[model samples]
Target: MTSTTTTPGGPALELDDIQAGALMPRPNPYAGAFWGLRIDDRHAGRELLRRLIPLLKPASSFDPERPVSLGLSLTFTGLRALGVPQESLATFPAEFQQGMAARAAELGDAGENAPEHWDKPLGSADLHVVVAVLARDTVLMESLITLAGDALRDIPGVVPVWYLDVHVPADGREQFGFKDSISEPAIEGTGILGSNPHEASLKAGEFILGYEDETGAVAPLPQPDVLGRNGTYVAFRKLHQRVAAFRQYLQQSAADRAEQEWLAAKMVGRWPSGAPLAVAPDKDDPELATDPTRNNAFLYGDDPQGLKCPLGSHARRMNARDSRINGDVRLHRMIRRGTNYGPSLPSGVTEDDGADRGLMFAFVGAHLGRQFEFVQREWVNDGSFIGTDEKDPLVGANEEGRFTIPNRPIRRRLKALPSFVVNRGGEYCFAPGLQALRWLAELDT
Candidate 1:
């Protein structure tokens, strides 16, 4: 049904495009345009989406306060019919090259023997599952997962249940009021780069911060470690929204609108301007959002105890820009991308003044322990990073397990902290290759 083959002296494979017969030379602007289908056949899953996408109409520009189409996500899982060859284990990069080549040739985006391996991350996926998400909200998605997962498991390669679900939404408010989704990064490539180069380089195993395994450091000879030469591990977390509760808390407390804004700023660790207290230290840089060079440039120059940025401020705690060297930033880095989904606050709420919504945090990198967890636990939760009594003023983990925003905007305080972040749902996954998919296809036959 698809055109694919090896040619004499061709280039390596292209792994960016997930749709069959479509190897995008770059990341698609529409990663937001995806769905899930765990079916009786592997090729069937790929073919179905490939055909369906083209037929579907383009998404319309979003309105600030309304629901758009509900979203669904897919990640691969399980192994029944597929059988990978022994040689593939020994020569994965080469095999990965082969598969990318075949898929690219099939796409006609590249000619036969184009000689290109996926510039994006590839080589681990073999299953697909979906998470249905609501526009302007995060609640329904988790509920849907809890609802639909049972039905989906009946499909093939469904064991351990699901692989990756759909992706996390972009951070930002639909109406653009508070600095929405301030922590989200604009992801580049097929996402295989694993968030950022600093942490991604350590994917094969443990590195600088820790090394529990042998292949922890990058190999001099060019080979992968135990996880599979081309494998990548993905962890996803989805939290819920409690607009009414948040509004009630924000309204009843705080002084005036400016004070409310200050409270909001303190909780998030930044003014809506994206300016870090570490540099601006005192004011909001509203213009930074427009200026690329200025927006994300603040660093914790000499302020160890958050003399500039508050120690527990979201920015300082997450990156520990507050932590330092002869003035060098920590080698550990994570490319974080997140989105806010929920109904906007009712303007007329006299009891609760602000809007009702919450955030979705997503990070991609090699070692989860060093990067994501590090930012969350050490800086955000532990008082040591900032030398303050406050934990991550906003995102500290709650007992229920979700990392939802706190009921009130956290302010500087001398007392013990109340956990703000709460967990709703999450899973870890691997984004694999088309060869893996075909290996999957062959099994179905």
Candidate 2:
């Protein structure tokens, strides 16, 4: 595919106007996008960027096994953490100039398209530290995810919104295949292709992540004490290892069930080569595999059992399709453009043993907990959907041991669970405003 966008020199084009949500095929350098989260006077964050921007050289190289880049997002929840003088957090934009924003058109339906502000009183967003792909070196991106995770551990209140330690499949699709990222909807004005719902539609201050004053822990919103110039909130998560096992299970499933590899393809909703199940349910649809429009078309008509596709399967459960009971579930869709990490498991390996391999899931939304959290807790993990208490068998967690999706006949054979993925370590972080940067630098490390 060809593109009209060029880095030649001019005001940047709106995000959606760029092809495939990118200026080119891979990541590129964004000069003024890096930001930090910390307490500071009004506009104090700028000083820190002035210092860090020059010290940081344009990246010369990326690691083969693990690359490093910064990804950025913000949260209004951090507004609660501020001194009286700088208490008005919503007015101040983030410190980074090149970063993405949720812009709304001025004409009709502009506010309608914007996330409802029911919970967004001031529209404050507390986030920083975006590890972008300056260039497309999968390894570099991988390292960047880890680097962001590791670095944020020490930053106070910097909650991680959503992250994906992904491996751009050698086949070019995401871990679930189905032509990675074909389903992301284009939201105008934000300069982003997002799946987020309007913040105005949500409850009071319920949209922020890491710290929700109303519902803490499961949904921690920013507090009034941290309101104006609140410390950052980093979203923390660790999708565990199971790459080798999943592949092995698929192969074994094919042999044990007497079905062909195509069956396994349907189970995953994609061909190993990135094709979508919607276009080719019985065979790997190569044409649809590459065409963005053709992917993500399959929806279970009414077979609650998911006979067409396993009810509890990842794709089916993630996007409940039209089956979702209310508008609540509609907000949970994530823009998962993450890649996988770790090696392509040896085809013959029986088990990953203790191999640290799995997806690095990165997603974005105005309020992390309301959308992603709701889906993981209610839909993905609920037994009602798949017939067992499995937290997204692949990405969910159970304190007792590893999580796995039970095989067919879920109604009766409820105990057979398979561990497809695991979770590791994580924390909450915030990508701060430029004024906040100086505060971070000023703080005693």
Candidate 3:
């Protein structure tokens, strides 16, 4: 159905046409904020979008050494509020139209993830827009927010309903003490693809809309050409991590510090230093982890029996490289950009810290139903494809699940896996291309 050969050439990425947040991560932003707003007046909302256009950051703004980033995404309701026609709105994927709460059961978001427990803005009908800002520190982030507010001062209809902030430590370690953002999919068009030749590059349409997907057909586009040409759907989620419980579990499971680290790596498929277990199975290799060219260069084919990397591990299941699956892996690939939020618990403190902390997960793709939702419902939360019923150890919602780690002496099974990650809230948003923003700004009520 899809091209099996790994094509070295891909469509040239139109960086300026795409929103920066959809393709690349902010350059080491220390602080960030997500502003969720509701549109009270369609005309005012359109004018506000016009005013905000100048502030929208394009994908071209990403500089690995830079210190500033800001971007915006809108819910389907937000677009409708801005005067986008009903015909165009109907063209969006059903998942986006229904919102995240409507399909909680399919996403395994029952119990704590029920709509009643979600943030008010995410579940309420009033939510329209989500503006995300990231910067090197709090002061810079505040300044940007202030500038945005000043731009929207004349627009009275847009009201802020919720604000969530993100905190990334200097060391770049998550609350669970592992290096995050270590692995990401390489898109064909984006020149940002690294020299990790082992991993195959995915089709451009897998991430960006209006491009040919893996099946060699241009992915579906929303009506009114400018509105959906280069835009992509985004699944924004706030995941809270129980750091104390996770650390305590590791401590009680393993006999010593080294074994504890090993158990943790087996669960995550990566060492604290960001070194993947598939490459450095025995110990943490900070050098390899730090090396961009070598860190993501391993595959699962060589160790089919889970010797190098367990098939059910979090990373392995999330992106199963060269693993046998019912369908092509490219079809399910998504651009995952997650940033740490909340303070890190003090080392060696086993008790729960009253402070709340976790990750702000953003999944960018063209097919929300097929790409993001399928991966969440199938790969991450269920392990049936890998011949196991257990979910991902660190983030899966199943507390009764167990993780089996294959070792030379014997396979180790870690049980009583409590849910370490909780869905604080989430929304399905549309990150439009620059032209779409302009089109939205010019819309008439």
Best by TM-score: 3
Q: lDDT of each structure?
A: 0.38, 0.39, 0.82
lDDT of 1 at 24: 14
How many pairs of residues in model 1 come into backbone collision?
40
Better of 2 and 3 by lDDT: 3
RMSD of each: 13.7, 12.8, 3.7
| Cα-lDDT of candidate 2 | 0.39
Candidate 2's displacement at residue 364, Å, is 1.2
In the range 1-445, model 1's lDDT, one tens digit per residue, is 2232221132211222122111111111112212234444554444433333332111122222443233222332322212323443343223123332233332221221122322111212433433323333335345444444444444453333233333233333322244443332322222222322222222212211112122335322112232232233334444444444444445555566666655556556677555545446556767765454555555555765444455555655566543552222343455554544445556435442443344444444444445555555555555553344345555554222212222324534423333333444343333333333333334433
State the number of backbone clashes in model 2.
Answer: 89
Q: lDDT (0-100) at residue 306 of candidate 3?
A: 88
Task: Give candidate 2 misplaced runs (Cα > 4 Å).
Answer: 1-48, 52-69, 72-134, 138-170, 173-179, 191-236, 256-263, 301-305, 324-327, 385-391, 398-415, 432-445
TM-score of each: 0.55, 0.55, 0.94
Q: What residue runs in model 1 are displaced by over 4 Å at the alpha carbon?
A: 1-171, 174-177, 180-216, 219-227, 250-253, 325-331, 347-357, 385-390, 398-411, 414-421, 443-445
